[model samples]
Target: MSFAPFSDAPGTLDAAATAARLPWSALAEEIAALLWDSTVSVPARSVLPLAQGGSLFVMPATDRSVAMTKLITFTPGNAGTGRPSIQGDVVVFDIATGERRLVLDGPTVTARRTAAVSLLAARHLAPVPQGPLLIVGAGVQGRAHAEAFVVGLGVQEVWIASRSAASAEALAAHVHALGAQARVVADADAALPHCPLVATCTPAQAVVLSATPRSDAFIAAVGAFTPTMVELAPALCQHVALHGTIVVDTGDAGHEAGDLLQAGLDVATMPMLRNVVCGPWTHGTRAGKGPVLFKSCGWAGWDLAAARLAMRRAAAEPPMPAAAVRVPA
Candidate 1:
């Protein structure tokens, strides 16, 4: 069956166009609003293992006016195969009419929304919002975080570290292109004390960051999404849990957050992003704390937030000439 794009049909945005629609500032705000919105409902995602050693994720979410589902695949073996390991689409629909409204690049949505979530966490939890940033792991997520922090937090400098020197340098160049001073660091641990804002975006097969950060550091760990995948040392997790605040993006992190789970941290007792954003807690309450750790596991609600922002931005613009428009992939 072939489905052609009708004149009134919602536009299918590619990665770049989708990114353009969901600006960091607006997207972060939308997510923050949605976090406390009772009208929005997000069911737990279903993960199915493919025969070829990959996983398919089916995540669905809905609000009073719109609904969305993110269908994506993650194939770790796809690395170096010239194809992205995570590729798919986020399909949005009008709740009243039940008509499809937009199709967004899923990987792009994941990267941006995840980074936006981190930005939102930083906005409320970071001891120092503007800063020299240290990102561990120079992959898509690392690059996305660098851009988000620079634009959203007005970060002026970024330090990148990866297992691959070439990858680290490439990310450094990307940061420099964003008009931020980029430094490639040989050791992420060595840079931790200097950077108040830190993001770990690694594969999560093992611990890559175990350093003791400054008392005011805000660390966002986005690498591990499973109980077995780990990026931070168990000791580090314990330290933060003991001294500082460890806020999770969602309650699902209870089982999916490897860094906390492995460290024997009871995620169920921790304050969620919703609590911090919607509750009465203030940054001043964290004075003299060791560090604030924001542990993020993937959630469909984040994708829905991105879709809402993208749809609003798309609606405000005048139609482009047919010839000037780039067809969606």
Candidate 2:
């Protein structure tokens, strides 16, 4: 049989387009429902090491659709020899027919969806905070978080902190250009007191950053995905012991994530995102600490959802033979 192929070039659907299409508040509600529904199931992800320094992730899930996505992350050190620091593709197929119908450049989708998930977490876990916002890490995810928060949540001020001062300054400039009050802070700790809402977007191995929220502060950490990568200290997990909910992308994966692992915590006890959104149990006095701690280990369901959304949007456009044609047997 002959299969058809369609490609979405990088920036084809710029950050704004992606942000507009996937509204964080709406998507967060949908994610909450999906999590509570028993029909939806996301299998454990499979990781494959690339010949270079990066690794590829094969994520598969079953719900209304049986979908699989392949994601690869290459570091600068590996890309120097002509490899991309982050590159890959996603192929979405029709469940019954097993027809590969949608092809997407994975990196763009990854960044957008990752930010979308972070926004969802912030919306559900953090209390409404006024004033400037603090974003740790000035990479793609950091920028996307700033854009999504301002557009999705009405955030006014944005302060960025990065290992690279230049990167932080550049991100701050971009945010200001977007009409939001923003600046780069040399000290993340100092920025924390002023901003009630803090998001850590770095991939640091240890607790490179910390925050002292004023009684009602909300923190969302999405940087670390593996056991070796950590952005928040273990003590932060103790915050959950005091008050608020700790929402993890998945219980099993959290145990493998550095923030949770280093904290010497058990993921099974950590509340999943759905629990916090649905209020499975009264959060109790801990709830008084603030809203909650939201941590994402990254999930395949997110990729599947994004792929589905992108495909639906593409179909609404003028039909292209390559996009609509079926494979020939």
Predicted candidate 2 versus true structure: per-residue lDDT over 1-329, tens digit per residue: 75444332222333344444455555555555556656666788887776754567777766665465655654635322444356666666667777665555666667767777777767665666454678998877788788778877888899888888877888988888878999888888777778878788775655856554555677778878878778877766666546556678667665566887777777777777666556754334254565466777788777777766666666675544443333333
Candidate 1 lDDT (Cα, 0 to 1): 0.89
TM-score for each candidate, following the candidate numbering: 0.94, 0.82
Give lDDT: candidate 1, residue 36. Answer: 81
- Which residue runs does candidate 2 get wrong by more than 4 Å? 1-30, 50-53, 74-84, 129-131, 282-287, 319-329
TM-score of 1: 0.94
Q: What are the Cα lDDT values of the candidates?
A: 0.89, 0.68
Which of the numbered candidates is closest to the native, going by highest lDDT?
1
Against the true structure, candidate 2 reaches a TM-score of: 0.82
Candidate 2 clashing pairs, residues 3+ apart or interchain: 74-85, 243-286, 244-286
Q: Mind giving the per-residue lDDT tens digits that candidate 1 earns over 1-329?
A: 76645665666777887888889999999999998889999999999999877899999999999899999999877765668879999999889987787888899999999999999999999988887899999888998899999999999999998998988999999888989999998989899889999999987878999988788899999999999889999988888888888999999998999999999989999888888888876666776777999999989999999989977877897763454344545
Q: After superposition, how far is residue 329 of candidate 2 from its true place, in Å?
A: 22
